[model samples]
Target: MSHQPLIDGFEFATAGARQKGRWPVRELPRLRDMLASDAGEIAYELEGTRDERGRPGLRLSLQGTLELRCQRCLEPMPFEVGADEVLVLAASQAEIDAEPADAHAPDRVLAGKEMPVRDLIEDQLILELPYAPRHEGCAAGAGQRADERISPFAGLRGLMRGKH
Candidate 1:
C-alpha cells in the first residue's frame, strides 16, 4: 500500500554495497500536493543501484518517469530521466573524505544516519526538471507558419537586388 516499499530491499549496511534493483512507483496526486501542484496519475518504474560505501554512504542511479505540464502548450509531458546520483550519508565532511573516492562520489553529502529514498527521489526530480517543457511539435508548427506568413529578411533581399 505504501510507496516506500520501492526501497524496501535496499541494504544500508555498508557504503559500498551494490543495490541494483527495480521497483514500481506510482505518483499519486497527493505526492504532488506537497509540491503545491496538481497532477494526474503517474506510473513508472525506478531501476538503478545504490553503491554503498563502508557504513551508510550510497551512490544511487536515479532513473524514472515524471508526468508534468509542458511549459509551452500546458499539456501533459512525461519525462524520463536517468541520473547517476551519489549521496554521501556521512555525519560530517571528515567522514565523507575518509571514504574511498570512486565513480560514485556524491554530489551532495547527507548529515544524517539514514538515507530516505523518498527524500532522494524528491531531490532527483527537482534536479532533473527542465526550465521549459514543450511538446515535440509545439514550436515547429508555430515557426513554420510564421515563416510562411512573412519572408525572413525581405527588406534585406530588396536592398541586395538593388545593389546588384
Candidate 2:
C-alpha cells in the first residue's frame, strides 16, 4: 500500500512520460478471487506513447509470481507472470466502437484526466490469468496415482474377454 499514482492520460501521452512501481498482491482487490494466497508482489512499468497513426497510447509491462490453485488437485501452484500490453486511448466509447473489430487489435481505454496506474495494471493482470489455472505437473494429479487407479469399466472388460 502506497500513494496511488494518477496521471492525466492525454497529458502523460503527450509528454511521453514513464512510471514504474511495485504493488503487493493482496492490495489488488479485483484479482484476489483468482489467487490462492495473497503473499507476493508485482512490478509494473507504464510508458506513454504516440503511435504512427497519431493515437495516444500507453504501454504496460508487468512481472511477478502469483500463487494459483490447481483446478484438479486444488493445491497451490506458483505462476510466473510477465506481460506487455499496449492500450490505445480513445476520446469516447463511440470512438472505440467505430474501430473495426479484430481479435488482434490492441485494447482501447477511454482517455481520462485522472487515470489510476494501479487499476490499469490490475486490468491487464486479470486478462493474463488462465481461464483454468492448473499446474502442468501436479504431484497430487493422476500421474502419481496411476498405479492405484481402477476404472469403473474393468468389470465390463472382463465380461467382454469371457474371463472370470
Candidate 3:
C-alpha cells in the first residue's frame, strides 16, 4: 500500500479542508500492540475547522473492529473501536503548555508544518481501547471453571472447617 499522506495543520485549518481514508491496523504502532490479530482496517475522517470559540481545530472520527485478547478468557475478542475528538490547534509547544488541562475542554495540540495523519488517528484509537477488554457472555469455562480449577487455599479451608 502507498504511504498515507501528511498534512500541514496550519494550512489545512486555514483552507478548511476535509479528508477521509482507511489505515491498515498493522501500521499503527501503539494500536497494533493491543491487537490479537493486526489484520483489519481503521476508517478515519478529519475536518479542519474553527471551533465555536473561534479556535483553529481539527475534528477527527475513527471507526474499526479490533481483535483483542479478552483479559478474563484469554481468547480473541472482537472489540469495536469508535472515537471522535476535537483538537484545538496551538502554534507552538509553549501555547499548548499554557492551556489548562480541563476534562471538559477539547484537547489542544501544537500545529506543525507536517502532521502525520496516521499518527493522529492512531492516538485516538489507543485512547478508545479498553484497559482490560472482555467479551460479553464469553464461552463457559473460559475463565476458571469450578470443576477444573484448584483452589490455592483449599487445605486451609478444610483445616478451618475442622474437616482435616
Candidate 4:
C-alpha cells in the first residue's frame, strides 16, 4: 500500500491556515478495503502550521462510518467513529524526539518533504480503535450468562473443602 500525498512540499508559518477537505478512503491503505466493503466516506479537518523549528504540526479531526465486525458477536456492525488527533511532522525521528515532551507526539515523519494524508488518516484510525470493541446493548445478558455458567466450586473450591 502506497501513501497518498496530502501536503506537497509546503511549509506553514506561525500564522498558517487550516486545511479542510474530504479525502477518499481508497487512497489510504488500511482504509481502502474497509471503506469499500462498508461503502462510506471518511472526512477530515486538518489544522496546522510550521513551528519555530520548522516542524509541521497539525490537529486532525476525523469523522466517518465504518462497517466492521463485532468482536463479540462476529456480526457486521456499522460504527460511526469520530477522533481528534494531534501530529507533528518532522524531518527525522531524532528531530521529533527532540521536541518538548509537552508537545504532541508525531504519528509520522515527513522525511522526504511530503505529508501524505492517507498515511495520516491510517494512523488516526488506528489510534482511535477501541481496546474492546463491542456493539451496544449486547453485553449485559452475555456477561451475566457466562458468570452464571461458571461453577463457584468447580475446581480449587472442592480441594479446599475436602481438606477442611
Candidate 5:
C-alpha cells in the first residue's frame, strides 16, 4: 500500500491478516547508512499468525537488492538480500524482557495498536545485509597481493649479518 498503515498486532493475528507491499530504498533512513546508493526497491509480505507455542506473531518475508561498497576494492557492488523472520508479540517491553533468551525461539517484540509497517519491513531488510560486502574476484586478488608484498624489515637482516 502507498499509504503507511498502523497494524494492531493482537487484532491482526486474531484475524489472520496478510499484506504485501514495496518501498523505495531511499525511504528507509536506517538502511541508508549501509547502502552505497539508494536506487532500488524492497518487496515485502507480512502475515499474522499464532506460532506453535500459541504466541501471536508476525511472519515477514522480504527480497531486495542493495548497492553496497566492496570492502576489498572500495567499489560499488550489488548485494542481493532475502530474509524471513517470525516476531512473537508481547503486551509490553517488560514482557519481552522477562522471557528467557532461547536460541530456538522466535524473537519477541512489544505489540502495539499503531505499529508502523514500514519500520518493521526496514528492520528485517537491514538484518539481511552482509556485515562486510566484497566482490569475489577482487577479494582473491587483494589476498594474493598481500602475500607477495616484501616486508620493510628485509634490509635489517643484511645489517645484522655485518654485510651493510
Candidate 6:
C-alpha cells in the first residue's frame, strides 16, 4: 500500500530475483471497488525469470479467494482467483511502441528504475477479473423468499379454474 518502489524492474529481471508474500486484499486500494467484501488475504509470488524463448521477464503468480457480488442475484459469493503471467520487459517505451500488434506476443512492460509491487499486482488482478461476475444457477429472483414473490397471474389462475 505504500508508494515506495520495490525494486528496479530491469535489475530485478537481470538478477533473477524472487519475492513472495501474503497481503490483505483490503490493502489494494485500486482493487477495492471490485470486491463485495475485502475480508481476505491474497498470496503473491513475483520472480525474475526468462520466458520460453529466452526473453527476460517477470513471472507473477497470485492465489486467493475473492468476495464478489453476483451480478445475477446481487448476492455475495466467493470466487477463487489463480493467475500466472509472464511480462516481457522492453528496453524502452519507444521500442515497445514501434512493435507490430500481435496476439501471440507476450505482454510488454517498459523497464524502469522504479516499479511498485502493489501496482503490478493490482494491474494483473484488474485484468483477470470477469466483467460481470455471477453465481451458478442464480437469477434476479434467486434469493427472494417465496412469501415475497409476486405473480400477476395469481388472480387469473382462480378465475380460469372456475371457468373450466
Q: Residue 109 of model 6: what lDDT?
A: 71
Checking candidate 3 for backbone clashes, the offending pairs are: none
- Name the candidate, 2 or 5, with the larger TM-score value: 2
**What TM-score would each prediction reach against the true structure?**
0.50, 0.81, 0.79, 0.63, 0.80, 0.79
- What residue pairs are clashing in model 5? none
Range of the 10 consecutive residues with the lowest summed lDDT in candidate 2: 155-164
lDDT of 1 by residue, 102-152 (tens): 433444344434445555555555555554555557753364232333434
Better of 1 and 4 by lDDT: 4
Query: Tens-digit lDDT track for model 3 on 62-102?
Result: 88899998767789988887888787788876665565544
Tell how far residue 114 is off in model 1, in angstroms. 3.0
lDDT by residue (1-164, candidate 4, tens digit) is: 12235564235313354666666655566655443254656888776655445666666789987766655776666767898754545555565445454313334344345656666667666545543445665653265233333344333321221221
Per-residue accuracy of model 2 over 39-149 as CA lDDT, tens digit each: 989998888887767789988899999998887789888889999877878887777767676555667787889888878888778767766665676666664444333
Q: Per TM-score, what order, best first? A: 2, 5, 3, 6, 4, 1
| Candidate 2: clashing pairs of residues | none
Q: What is the lDDT of residue 64 in candidate 6?
A: 94
Model 6 scores worst on lDDT over the 10 consecutive residues at 155-164
- What TM-score does candidate 2 get on C-alpha atoms? 0.81
Whole-model Cα lDDT of every candidate shown, in order: 0.45, 0.75, 0.73, 0.54, 0.73, 0.73
RMSD of each predicted structure: 15.6, 14.4, 13.9, 13.8, 14.8, 16.1
Q: Indicate which candidate wins on lDDT.
A: 2
> Which lDDT value does model 2 have at 104?
58
Please say which candidate is ahead in TM-score: 2 or 6.
Answer: 2
TM-score of 1: 0.50
Clashes (candidate 5): 0
Poorest 10 consecutive residues by lDDT, candidate 5: 155-164
